[model samples]
Target chain A: MIGVLLLTIRELRAKKIILGLFGVATLVWVVLALALRLDVIEGSLAGARLFGEEMSGDSDLTDELGEPALGNSLLETFVFGAEMFAAGAAYWVGILLALFATGGLIASMLQQGQVDLLLTKPLSRSKILAGRLLGVSVVMLALLTYLLGAVWLVMSIKTGIWNPRFLLAISVVFVMFMVLYSLISLTSVWTGSTPLSLILTFGLLFASLILAIKPLHEQITQPGRSIVVGLYNILPKFVDVGAHIVPQLVVGETVESWFPFVSSLAFGVVAYALAFRLFQRKDF
Target chain B: MPASAISVKGLSKTYNSAFGKQEVHALRPLDLTVNEGEIFGLLGPNGAGKTTLVKLLLGIVHPTEGSGELFGISIRSPEARKAVGFLPENHRFPEFLTGRETLDLYARMSGTTDMDRANKSEELLERVRLTGSAHRRVKTYSKGMMQRLGIAQALMSNPKLVFLDEPTDGVDPVGRREIRDLLLELKAEGVTLFLNSHLLSEIERVCTRVAILKEGRLVREGTVEELTTQDRIWRLRSTPIPDQSLGDHAHLVSDAQSNGLSEYRLHAADRTALNASLDHLRLAGVEIESVEPLRQSLEELFIDVVEDAST
Candidate 1:
């Protein structure tokens, strides 16, 4: 097992495409977080001033006022800004990062015949597949760590009060990314081609998200509410994790929902095991 | 002496294809044995089942019928594989790894744990003359370099027997000579080499014994001298002697004049009769310049075997 792991690490180091993609992913996450922080600052200051004026019962704070008063403390504004950024950008970043990293890792190995080389070794087929999965998982974790640290640093400079719950949200987001990456890795092996694997992974994610939204949309006087609800039950509700985490962090609400986490982990493990078995049976 | 390095009895293989399931009896129930410390050559033309035999020995492809043993272990058993090293024809390796790394990986996989795999890798690289470029990626290496690396990897585990399929297929003249020398060195070290190649000159030069296959059947098998001796041919050159004055039993095979010299090849039943005929010609005042037996070249022998089998 260690031999397979060392060999996998060596192969990954030799591949420039994976390294370049990871670098680009890190840069994009940092930039998005920074931009989101700015928007949150602007939006929060405007919202707080509107609320304070209404509470003060000032006649001059009329309904016709185009601009609301700026908030008093920069720290309060920054925390509000960071929370807003997490709600809007976290899911998209997680999904894309998972897809790109997992897809690129599998494709690069296949294209270079690395898997063939590793299998020719004395190591078992399962160990080789597991080593690759482990490597990709580590890379995802590292990138998530970097992104979380960057976001917290930017937000900390703007806001005095540091929220540990924001860090916890990032950790949950990393776990979600890992589940998605495992699915993509398995699909890449199953499909045996890069473009096709990426397409299937993205297609499944999109389908799941769309299905999760149908129940809410159908309740607004739409027909086929039962069918939408059935789909909502069948498809994975990945967005619920983010929705649940963000609200608990911002509103101080402790909600319990471990089903999605357990289900995603279970699916990921089974997919990985199946992919490894198929790969072992394949001639090349 | 107790056990043959390799033993194959009645080994045969058939392929099922889309064109009406054409069956090719590759081995044709052949029997073969190679003793320890001998260089055995499997000489044949294209589609002669040499590669099939090697694949069977390596357990890459299953045999349709018959069985063999390597180093006293059954061919089907995985334990038997530990004693065999194979350099497949047109074999491919991962292009991402360096030459040194390639050898190290194979050595480790072959169950050489906690040992000096790196040292073995370096030694083998130097043996194949790829030491200087050991760190360069395989993709950047030339064809000859790749072949050298392939040979190095095959020898990494120090197996009891090595199966090399066209080991010098794309090598240059110098590289071919070097590889031939290496095979001889390995043979001297008591390692059995199962060499499969169409290059009869190589087989003739290094093989202690050889077997020829045609269309998946063993057409001929013996020492180089034995195979060459099966067919008789002799070339004679002498001064002009009138055909009417020639002694009895002097049938001319070919008579030609080159640079004012006459050359004639004669067909005789035996060496004594040939000598008698040569003496009679000399006594008849036909000055003899050179009289020598023209043994069959390996190429000629190979062509004759394959062509005869086809017919």
Candidate 2:
């Protein structure tokens, strides 16, 4: 397993997925660093927004909306906004890129000439497949860490605000990828087609995001609710999980209990189990 | 002591295709034993179950019926493959890895570690004449180079038995000779080799034993000399043919006056009679050039076996 992991790591590195992820992160960070400026001028929170080096607006806390703020504090607003962008734009784009990049690991590995070499090894097929999954998981985690960490750093360095809560997106995004990537692997194993795997996994992710609405959950009848609940139980709640991190980062408040994490983990375990079972029995 | 490095009894494989609408019997129930430390060649036409047999031995594909043992271990057990290495036909290695890295990866897969993996990888790369290109990515390698690297990968573990399918398929003549020499070196170390190839001449030169598989069954199996040799036939080429060709002891295979020399294929009842006929030729004052036992080339034997099975 370690040997397989080591080779997988080499494969990811050589394929330039790692470098490409870092490049996207760096580009995002540079843009964020230039556009937003947060400062404490004369004991009042002031923010300067720039549009291509031209100051678009200068807002002092008392001057922007009213004398007294009604909703979130300036610090909460800044942190919340940064985390949301990270989740909405950075995280979503990263997942799409990962779908395009890492989706082929299983499909390509299972090709006739390719699988024959690995299957003939002294290890069981399950271990080989698990190693591949864990390898991609590790790469996804590294990419998430770099992209999230860069955003956190730029936010802190530019705005002089450091919220450790933003770092939680790293784990949340990783879990989200795990849940979706499991289906990716399962589909790849079944079809042995990378394009089909990508389409199915991406479609499932989009569907999950739409179904995560609380209003949508409330409107469904008993049987409809049962089917929706069954799907929610097995698939990751992408929008819920991604959007949930914003409020958590802002108020440091926990929401939605442990159901989301448990269900996603269950989804991953079930998908992986199904994939392993099918892969073991596959003729190669 | 174990009798064979590889032993299979009534092993078979049948797969369903077209959504299980059709049954394809890839291999029929067959028994085979490859004795220890001999180069055994599996010769056949395309789709002749040669690769299927190798896959069955490696446990890459499950056998529908019967069992196989590698070095006394059940083929169904992973431990049976612990000391076994295989190079499948039209194999594709991880193209991103360099030649050395590829060997190291495959060596590590066989459970080699640390210093041993490094040493064995370097040794194999050099053995396959890829020492200079060890650091080059496999994507940069030519087809022949990839084939050599495949050889290095198979030998990484210093496996006791190695199955090579089309070991020199895309290799040039020089590379083929080098691969042949490498196989001989492996044999010298007492490694049992199961070679599957359509290259009859290559198999003829190196294989101590050969099996001809037609369709899904083993039609013939024996030593190369045994399979190619035809009994009761002698090829004679000599000058100045006698009008009556050694009486009825010999029969002409072709016209005697076709060339300056007359060629005759003689079928004598025994060695005594064959020597007597040769002695008669000499006494008749016909200048004798050469007399040799008639034998079929591996190609001829393979074609005959497959054609016979088809008919």
Best model per lDDT: 2
Query: How would you encode candidate 2's per-residue C-alpha lDDT over B9-124 as one tens digit per residue?
Result: 99999999869999999999999999999999998888888889999899788899999999989998888988888888899988888898888887888888788988888788
Per-residue alpha-carbon lDDT of candidate 2 for residues A142-235, written as tens digits (9 for 90 to 100)? 8788777887888777666677877876777777778888998999999999989988987988888778876877799998988887787677
Off by over 4 Å in 1: A21-120, A127-192, A213-270, B7-34, B43-49, B59-69, B73-79, B91-96, B113-115, B212-222, B231-295
Candidate 1 lDDT over A2-111, as tens digits, reads 55556666666666755765576578556644453322353243222221232221222111233221233433544644454653365566557556645766655554
Show the colliding residue pairs in model 2.
none
lDDT (0 to 1) per candidate: 0.69, 0.82
Evaluate model 2: give its lDDT: 0.82
lDDT of 1: 0.69
**Per-model DockQ:** 0.15, 0.62
True contacts kept of each: 0.16, 0.72
